[model samples]
Target: MPQLQAAVKELQEKGIALPDYPDEPGTDAERDARARYDKVKGSAVNPVLREGNSDRRAPASVKNYARNHPQLMGAWTPESKTTVATMGAHDFRSRQKSVVLPADDVLTIKHVAADGTGTVLKDGLKVLQGEVVDGTFMSAAALEAFLAEQVARAKAEDVLFSVHLKATMMKVSDPIIFGHVVRAFFADVYTAYGEQLLAAGLDGTNGIAAVLAGLDGLEDGAAIKAAFDQALADGPRLAMVNSDKGITNLHVPSDVIVDASMPAMIRTSGHIVGTRR
Candidate 1:
């Protein structure tokens, strides 16, 4: 835990209020610490940089297409018996853009392998002084509040809750956030077994199915699974990615992105697929 403390110190020194890194944290302090770490892990970056000037409008292409293809867009009617609910980290849209300047630039991406090898991912292009680049969140408290509000709202409204994240584009980031939502939704299970799960190479950022699958050889796997099942029963209704397979939207990060899922929900008159039952 000293290492975690040191890491936390390092981040804090750099202005990041990172939670105490939880490596099999057990006590309430540890569990709370873990929760802190999880909440802060993914999807918590956009708000800070937004500073109210970030670009968040729908793209021109989407608007123009919507205008030309009204039929493709859905009209909200009072008689429509559909409810499409969507939520994601606020930073999901709080994205900033940096342009490549023409004058001076020296930025490069490197790929490091486990064997201590390095490969260049991108060579920094020369850029002018005014050129921009973007930085990307919740790896703690900020994200936990956002997700909790979403769950509480959905519960009060009695509507299916679905999270829409840019898992594909974000690749590592979004999925990690998705995992946090999973952990938040099933707090008890993770609190009790996060240590074990982490041992199994599972973290809160993978699909629930992955966690379930990762439980394969662990001793308390069956008991933990039961907890997950009970969680589904006790929590707010979740939107399904495949109700037939008992797969929920929180199963994978990129499974349900906003752009794709939002329009699809509209097309279906505001309800997610596989929730008719």
Candidate 2:
């Protein structure tokens, strides 16, 4: 901890400010400095601290204390419309395949397209004996259809629409999924100006704030912005991460992680401590 603290202090002394969030604005030099510093931030220490075990559980002592002194609970009723939506088919869970390594070896993962073109996804991956390796894919068509249905369901049921993903942990896949969610939610806007938005270099994969950040550079930026606003107005009451700041759940990928959020929801009777719309 002291070493980490000293490293942070040294960075600060060099005029590199590390904020709680990654989106803080800075000069090009400061931003470059932050790019390096970010490698040490958040769960970067998990490999050292966790030592391969990431399945988190409270200790017996803490559990005993919690059982004795219970916290305030949120009310739940049979009439509650809260629901857990998931794609039981064509999702990662359904499509996962696993294999246990019988011997230590280096491997490569490749993809073959419909046209018989091959591409290397990963190479030189080392594995040990008895280590379990798994691979999974979620169908984009199925994901989009699922999201579209959920959005319409939320609107129909007059419920708050929100998505929780572990982008920080499931770094590659979750961000891509989050991007699909954003596109699905703002279907009309994307349908109308997707080509232009893509041309302007505003990728939805980085989150809505990123897309919004680059809007000023587009010739039709104002129109695109208005369309986003209109989508929000027309869509179901979206859950706000911070109603005070107009920060929706879709604004940032790291704000709501499943493990962190599920416990909070359980404590609050399925509530995420956020307002609707």
TM-score of 2: 0.80
Question: Model 1, 25-70: lDDT tens per residue?
Answer: 8788889987865664554445433335556788999999978878
**Would you give me the overall lDDT of model 2?**
0.83
Go through the candidates in order and give each one's C-alpha lDDT.
0.72, 0.83
> What would you estimate as the lDDT of candidate 1?
0.72
Local accuracy of candidate 2 as per-residue lDDT tens digits, 88-195: 999999999999889877889998877999999999876767768888888889999999999999999988888988898777889899989999999999999999
Off by over 4 Å in 2: 1-42, 45-49, 52-57
| Candidate whose TM-score is highest | 2
Per candidate, the number of residue pairs that clash is: 23, 0
